[model samples]
Target: MAITSANQLELLQTAEAVAREKMIDPALVVEAMEESLARAAKSRYGSEMDIRVSIDRKTGRATFTRVRTVVEDEELENYQAEMTVEQAKQYMANPAVGDQFVEEVPPVDMGRIAAQSAKQVILQKVREAERDRQYEEFKDRAGTIINGVVKREEYGNVIVDVGRGEGILRRNEKIGRESYRPNDRIRCYIKDVRREARGPQIFLSRTAPEFMAELFKMEVPEIYDGIIEIKAVARDPGSRAKIAVISYDNSIDPVGACVGMRGSRVQAVVNELQGEKIDIIPWNEDVPTFLVNALQPAEVSKVVLDEDAERIEVVVPDEQLSLAIGRRGQNVRLASQLTGLDIDIMTEEEESKRRQAEFEERTKLFQAALDVDEFFAQLLVSEGFTNLEEVAYVEIEELTVIDGVDDDTATELQARARDVLEEQAQRALAHARELGADDSLIEFEGLTPQMLEALAEDGVKTLEDFATCADWELAGGWTTDNGQRVKDDGILEKFDVSLEEAQSMVMTARVLLGWVDPEELEQGNEDEIDEDAVEASEDEA
Candidate 1:
């Protein structure tokens, strides 16, 4: 269809066809045409002149107008696009400032090049409109399962056509066991959708743990009805997966319900996952119990938990250790992910050997360090005094309560422990100072000698590094990477700073640095200082 024609119906029909083909509103196409015609008109009428074009929706006839705002003689900025009120009075009497005058000009018939330019403008505008439409259509669909037909494959990535737009299932997102040719139907999790310069990129994922959870939700009626809830899921993508489920109703067993009659329900989900094995376990609020359940087919004898550290030690029968850890540690690894805790597995024999070694070491430490006899050392070890620090820092009343230990002996023992720690602190301080640690840092209130040494050893000798250190950096356990777990402590862990205490210490350093006014922080900006003279203010903040 010709973009430029004397027949106005042809223009309207062309707009309708282009809008339908581009999946945009026909009115937007007409506006684009008006903009294009305005460009053509301005090219002939001088680019500096303010020219506008409007198209009739029904008749499709195009009209051009030259617009000028009437202003007082003193207010005119441009002579071509602005007119004085006295000059405007020729068209309308008593023209006032800010009044606009529009004069209709006859439509200029376009040549072939102008028509092509109009088509390009229309196509560009339609594409922009289609992108906006696709963004709005797919943005809310993130996390929902979308069904689409395979449109094509590029570099092993499947591009699916999902009616309103195309969705991309990146190669990494495809399940290991699945392959598709053109026109094959597939369902994928709408992992994310975003607008880009090329158009909307609707990303699909099949390997996401959420994708398996979504599949279970589709296959299990109880899960779909919200009676049984999926607490957490971890998948090795077509290899194996573990899901923790909980039922609100006491009469319904969550695991049995998820497994279905003779495993039919779970088998259906497994079929969809391309024969991936699934282990559905009951969820418990107690993490240890949940972890025990998470590691199925292997019996757990006992679980020793360190809640503050978010780590669990599970002891199983000697023969079950291999089974509990699974082949290549996959079972325990999935358990860690599903329970959100780091798991350390040991055989009963291994644990017994470890406990025996720890008992002997602690006894020896207490025997020599506290100058106590073997019997007294055993008593202290039995009382859970693992190190001299516990004996030094614990209350005198706690020490005196130990069997065969009087108040006087407890006091002497505590004094000896304190003396040992102090002597070690002095040696560490001397070493730190030799490493160029400043006196000001050593004298800082919250910092201890060991913390100072840890800083010095790491080349963080200045007050600036202390001020800039994060709570996690000081207390350790700061997650540096976005991986599933952290394997080591930060440098400040040697100083024994809790996360809360580390936060306080960092705040103290900031106050000492004068970066943040303490009063302003406490009052939440109720009062602020305009102290512009403070050096490095916010330059390092």
Candidate 2:
């Protein structure tokens, strides 16, 4: 092949044809041709020579050039491509260390081997450009639903021909046992788009919770218009699912709108999900109320929520227990997912028994700690005094309100509770000292004696050790491990040390040890407050 006048126009024609076939920019194809021609020219010319090619976009003309750069004397390595400053003076009146000298070169008459190599270079460039184009086209389409034709199945994975690109629906992402032959129509969620060595990968999913939400958005006009919002979704794909929705317009019932007239809208989504049964629930700002709605078809007798732990206890009638738990606990699992809480479901009888057990335990603690008889301890428990601290520090009027108890009796009860607490504290302090606790930690103003003993047992005995501890380490926290929330026990957690208190105590220790500047800490706190104030004002606005 030669870059003659007859073939010069052919180059641009071929570029246009290839660009049209690839659905890429014609300029990119032309650039690829230029690079391939340059590579061929380098083979014809000395390999050491810097050869370049340019194609005229308007006229389809090819221009070849030989380039040599001026360099410092010691930096000149390639004699054919680089020239020293002094040696470049022959071509110009004055040449600096960084100057390129270009001269026109004759086009290469490519042989069979050279032409084949050039063809490979152009193909590689075109493939890269096509990959880039596909990535750009579909990147923003993620988190959306797309219609595609199933191309084939590799192992359990399905490959779909999503116009202009290929999407992969992995086995785990498919609804249970979904099997498709070639050319089968499929609808899937664009879960992710990634650029990889082979090509841009468009991962599709049929089992994502978002897929069900998107389906509702498609089938429900109110959802698409933002009148109804899908607050949460949980799916056992191909089996059962739950969706919680809310309506901003008071006249619009979110659940009714999602269920549609005669269940038309939800039926459409259900049909697409391979007959997955869906329970549409109204979303409530109150978590317990929302949870009650989530576990539908089952009556809830009581709901006890531990907000800090993101856990909930639901008491249902014994007859409703099986319904609330579902077959194999699926109903409760989906409800938990929908509400983002760990649910402990029990029968009303079970909850009552547990309550009674707790009452008996509190009575026992009061009987032992305050030296009270069983009846007196039971009376104290009934008065809502669970621990000695409350009994010791509560107003005397609170105790006096109990039956057969006067001011004198209340005073005597508080005195005994305080004395017992003091003794317990002294014993805790002694045990902590035995565990090598220093006075620096014992005298820390906010920590109780029990906290000191816990810290010492956990190998954090000194003030220095406390200063090095993270706030979460002292106040306990929940961490996600393998997609499950695990509890991390904190040394001071039993002492009711909140995360904020732990942070403040640690900062105080750091300041006392000269490890952190008090002025800087104060300034940081002021800055945080100012930022918070700005955010609050913006939210109000």
Candidate 3:
């Protein structure tokens, strides 16, 4: 059967209805219909001829045309689709190249195969239009809440029917204690929206900490209006959670504000989380003060902070140690996470013992480094000289201030400490050379003896090996541990070579040896090095 002239208006009405049902612009359907008609009309009109169709929006009438553009003789790429201006002028007057002329073609009498092909084209276009519209609608909605009804479960993954689209909530995203059935209304956070070959997938989550934070934002007006704010949040799913908050207005209490009027606001969030306990603590600007608040219900008597290592040692009363650490260390772990520092909790007795051990270590170091008697060593250690570096670097006048130390004794102690350092450096260099370190590497200024030994073990025995070393290799963390080796994070973790110093050493070795050009390296050309960069290699050799 062929589609007759009487059915052309029906085609336009059908396209408009499908567009409305699919929630896409009707113009897309109209465009798809036009292409289908043009393809179907190809057999009647010549196959090589340019063909086009347009449907009137108001009257639902379709018109077909044979469109050919006028071109110069040299510009003729296709004889059937383009006509030379001389040929075009036979039909019209003063025609110029690049001008398009329309020739009327007969209406298409769409046969069974033609109508089937048009149907496939329309369906594909509508499906593609739906996916695009869905992507645009939900892409900006990520990290926000969306309400949907559970459609069904497939292999433990739940499908949801959001108002405008469908989404998937994987098993891992659901709270471990939560269960859902079909038609169950649920609120989920849109974690991501991805475009895939099948369709747009909107991924939802319920266990994300951001989801709980968002819930707080909705329940608390102070947070919403910026009176009080939530700083950080951590969750153990439905078991327990903690949130840190701070207030902008000095008179406002951040914790009281978050707890709400008789605990109304926080309770709403708690109910949603299935009775999970939440510790809402007031945030402090000082890390130590904030840490004290994070470890609520525990009393601290002492705090030793190591800012360089980002670690904190908190000393609690003996009876409070278990409470401070919490059941399974959860309390201290949460506090560490909230403070961004590694924390160690100990009782007062332990801290006292540790302090005594440190005193002995410092006293021994001074007695050996300065050739002092026991009483003098204790006097130096009590004055805060922990290592030989302090003894060698301190002013002779400052040393003379130590009780019973005369000017001559101070000068002799300083000279002896310096001599010991010089001897150590010489012995270290000799040991490195004996381990097969190349002369060129041995002469390098920045590398220490231990670094040379580490490199020698890895077969980087020559200056050329040092020059060819990547900045990462010099930066050190690449060794593996087995058998007698200890588990080390990186080579520099055991030594002291910083990445910046290693970078300088590698580049200087390469440039000084003429293995690379300073200007060539600067240009970053990698491929083109002028004669100068390469020519110096032999002279340095």
Q: Quick one: best lDDT, which candidate?
A: 2
Ranking the candidates on lDDT from highest down gives 2, 1, 3
Per-model TM-score, in order, reads: 0.86, 0.97, 0.84
In model 3, which runs have C-alpha deviations exceeding 4 angstroms?
1-5, 43-49, 69-101, 301-318, 344-358, 447-498, 514-541
- The whole-model lDDT of each prediction reads 0.86, 0.94, 0.82
Candidate 1 lDDT over residue span 175-288, tens digit each: 894889999999899999988889999999999999999988988888899999999999888889999999988999988988889998899889888888999898999988
Task: Tell me which of candidates 1 and 3 scores higher on lDDT.
Answer: 1
Q: Is candidate 1 or candidate 2 better by lDDT?
A: 2
- How close to the true structure is residue 209 of candidate 2, measured as C-alpha lDDT? 97
TM-score of 1: 0.86
Hey, what RMSD does candidate 1 come out at? 6.1
Distance from true position, residue 246, model 3, in Å?
1.8
Q: Which sections of candidate 1 miss by over 4 Å?
A: 1-6, 20-23, 70-98, 392-412, 418-469, 482-492, 509-516, 524-541
- The per-prediction CA RMSD against the true structure, in angstroms, equals 6.1, 1.5, 7.7
Better of 1 and 3 by TM-score: 1
Worst lDDT window (10 residues) for model 3? 483-492
lDDT string, candidate 3, 23-100, tens digits: 899999998988888888886677888999888887777888988899889889877789999899888789998888
Residue-level lDDT for 102 in candidate 1: 94
